[model samples]
Target: MNGNRFGRLFQLTTYGESHGDAMGVVVSGCPAGVELSTEDIQRDLDRRKPGQSMITTSRGEPDEVRIQSGLQDGYTTGTPLGMLIENKDARSGKYEPFVTAPRPSHGDFTYSAKFGTRNWGGGGRSSARETVNWVAAGAVAKRVLEASDHDVRIKAHVSQIGDVEAPEVTFEEMLEHSEENEVRCAHPETAEEMREVADQHQTAGDSIGGAIYFECRGVPRGLGAPRFDGVPARLAQAMYSIPAVNDFEYGIGREARTTTGGEYNEDWEFDGNGDPTPVGNDHGGVQGGITTGQPIYGEVTWHPPVSIPKSQRTVDWETREEKEIQVVGRHDPVLPPRAVPVVEAMLYCTVLDFMLLGGRINPDRIDDRPGEYDTDYHPRSPENVDD
Candidate 1:
């Protein structure tokens, strides 16, 4: 619970449970006077909502966002932004059987072991349902980034489902074709195949895992710090927080194990603007923990939903006896496709917060003809502030 907060400057603290009255987020450090509305955040929540597709959970929660506080006349108030989404269709009775019997590959055991108690209703804080706040918070982060001078754009798509991989696509292609399919894969042929795979798994009462690729363009160089707060470190930390996520890789990632340094090195060259640009993104747009003014790309893998219909063995908390369970709740047959926006949202928070921590970027002044950011907030250094 202590680690529920994320980011250093543009921070978010989420509360509520899977079957709680409402799940919400408190966003802090947002500058005053940025265009914001419930509609802006609701769109992203709709994308994260359940029952959107047959492959996803059939829970009928509308996931409509409500801005509780921190906005005045459609702009941030430089105060904590409060937002919430009510749990309209949680069906806690469906989880009654799980009160004593923990599901396999779920946080039921770990959460109980750590806290001495746990909410058995729909896995409580351990549920993907909690990401409504993340997507909502990410929606705010996107506005912060959009308010800045830089034209940073973030996009993500399902690149792989089960053993099936989508054809490689560019960032623009991802934007164009991701929503064309229910699975949210950019490759039309592969998206069809992924849907078919999900159908097959659904018929068999099994679940499958897959990976998603995320790309962020226009990420200004020098966004992250060296050592502890490196871009990779922050990105990994943000990503691993999502439920069912099992792995995080950037650039060539694990592929580099087979690639020699000589082959991996992408020589730099000057562009039309004389900015140093890498001929290739083999480094995934980062070097030495800093953005290289290139498109930052990475991939995240989510394990299959743990609550499949097939019977699985688990231990009883009270009886200390082994038992079998056929998890009957609604769940996603494939998770990575739905994960695309979540990835984009987390990436936005990480980068936006890093920018805030690094320097002052006034969204209003970013449009100045001179192309200079406003320094209303001097850097939070000892020399800039008085005791």
Candidate 2:
């Protein structure tokens, strides 16, 4: 109910629940006069909307967006921009059983304890559905960043679906391939395999978890607040807000913990232009809580959807008795592909806030850089590409 706002200078506050009639966001502190419209927000929403692929939930929500205010003639008015998306396909009845029996691996039990009651339908505020607002706000933030001539772009893709994964591709390549498939993976072969696995899991009444890799381009140095708003902390905060995100890390994540400093620390050097250049991409673009101006990259891992058609044991909070619960309602068999754009939106928001803090660019006017950076990231196909 509280703490929905993110960022200091360019702030965004999101509200509404999954089954609520509508979800929306209010963005404030944005500079006046940047090009924007409901279509811009709707474009991203369409990517995150359910039923886009066979691997995702079958919910039929169009996730249509409507901009209530904050712009004139397709540009920001410098006031708080308000936007909302109606939830057209909610079936609150699917959550009737959870009135007493909470779903495991979800916030229901804890929310019940803390709030003493909950909407239960579509997991209420805890639902991944809430992130639609983030995407909406992010669309505006992205425009703000773009207007500043920052020459930055954010993108995400399904890197791994259970055991199937694509080969590591460059940031530019990933952007090229992400939107090509429902799984939002660039590699055709791997996306197919991942889709097959998702289908199998759905058939078995199960769900699968996977990893999402994100890349940030053209982010100038000195964007973080240090010690607190450090790049990692900000990115982590935004990433964790996505429901089902169970783990996060950059530059090897847990793998780094297993190595010695000698093996882990990235050695620095100077490029021919005398600018500091990372000897390797090991650090993933952040050191000492600030950007190195390289591609800021990292990943978010989503746990398998906790709700499954197969019955599972849980306790009836009121009865204090153990019982089997078959989670009903629409649920994703796999969330990686659809999550790609959502991650991009969050990354966009994070970078926009960082850029604002760094003063590298301002809204209303942006520098002219014709595709300063080109992304070459491509997803690997599990069926053909080898590790």
Candidate 3:
């Protein structure tokens, strides 16, 4: 309950259960005068919503977003942006079998132990369904960054599904082709392979783990602090917050383990504009805990979804007897495809928070001019001739 909020200056507080009335979020500290609409948030929600394809959950929630507050005309008001998404297809009956038995590798046991009682319906608040709020808030963050002077762009793609891995792709390829396939991998051939893998798992009543590759471009330098507050540290926290995300790594990532220091360390040279630049991007944009004005890229790995049709053993806490449970429900066989947007959203929120903290973008308003009411982003009064 206390950990629902995220970010420092640009904060997001979420509320709701997976099978409850609706999921909602209140985004605070967003600058006023940035153009935003429910459609903008809905676009990202559509990507993360359940029942997207054969590989994803079969639940039929529309995930349509409703903007409840914090806007005047069509722009943000610098107040808490309240948004809501109702759950239309929540079938709590499917989860009743595990209410006391608890599913394997799930938070069911821990939640019950900690809270004494829980919603116990669709995993309650621990569900990835909660990320709907994140994608909503991240849409706002993305719009804020776009409307600002910074040209920050965040993109993520499904890089691996089970044992099938995609070939390395450029940012341009991600933009052009990631969404073209159901797997959301940038490489079309690999995406087909990933899809086939997911289908195999789905047919077997099992689930598979996968990884997502994310990149953030146009993020300014000096947007992060040292040690605990490093950009990489915060990003890791963001990525790990997503359910099932077991691993996070940036820069050369695991490759740095075997790489020699001489080969891993990037040499600095003057750019054509005379600014110091690294000859290569093995560091993935951050050096010494601060951004180096280069692209920040990384991968987030998720464990297989615990909820599957396969029978798993667990104990019924009340009966004190063992039980065999089939977590049969609408569930995704692979996670990376749906997770791509979530990764991008978290990156947008994290990057925008650092931008505001670093004074690279205005915290109060996108225009950066305080007490000046008559800006282009603001609504204009009706002309006198309108009478």
Q: Judging by lDDT against the true structure, name the best candidate.
A: 3
- State the lDDT of candidate 3 residue by residue for 1-387, as single tens digits: 599999999999999999999999999999998988888998999999988899989899999888999998898889899999999999999888888898999999999999898998899999999999999999999999989988899999999999998889999999999999888999999988889999998999988999999899999887799999999999999999999999999988999999998999888999898999999999999998999999999999999988888877899989999988788778888888998989999999999999989998888887843355655553355552345
lDDT of 2 by residue, 235-277 (tens): 9998888888889898667788688989877778988989987
Q: List, residue by residue over 115-135, the lDDT tens digit for candidate 1.
A: 988887888998888898999
TM-score: which candidate is best? Answer: 3
lDDT of each: 0.87, 0.83, 0.91
Q: Determine the C-alpha RMSD for candidate 2 after optimal superposition of all C-alphas.
A: 11.4
- What shift in Å separates residue 113 of candidate 3 from its native position after superposition? 0.5
| TM-score of every candidate relative to the true structure | 0.92, 0.91, 0.95
Ranked candidates, highest TM-score first:
3, 1, 2
Q: Quickly count the clashes in candidate 3.
A: 0
- Runs in model 2 with CA error above 4 Å? 363-387
Clashes of each: 0, 17, 0
Between which residue pairs do clashes occur in model 1? none
Reference-based TM-score, model 2: 0.91
**Which 10 residues in a row give candidate 2 its minimum summed lDDT?**
365-374
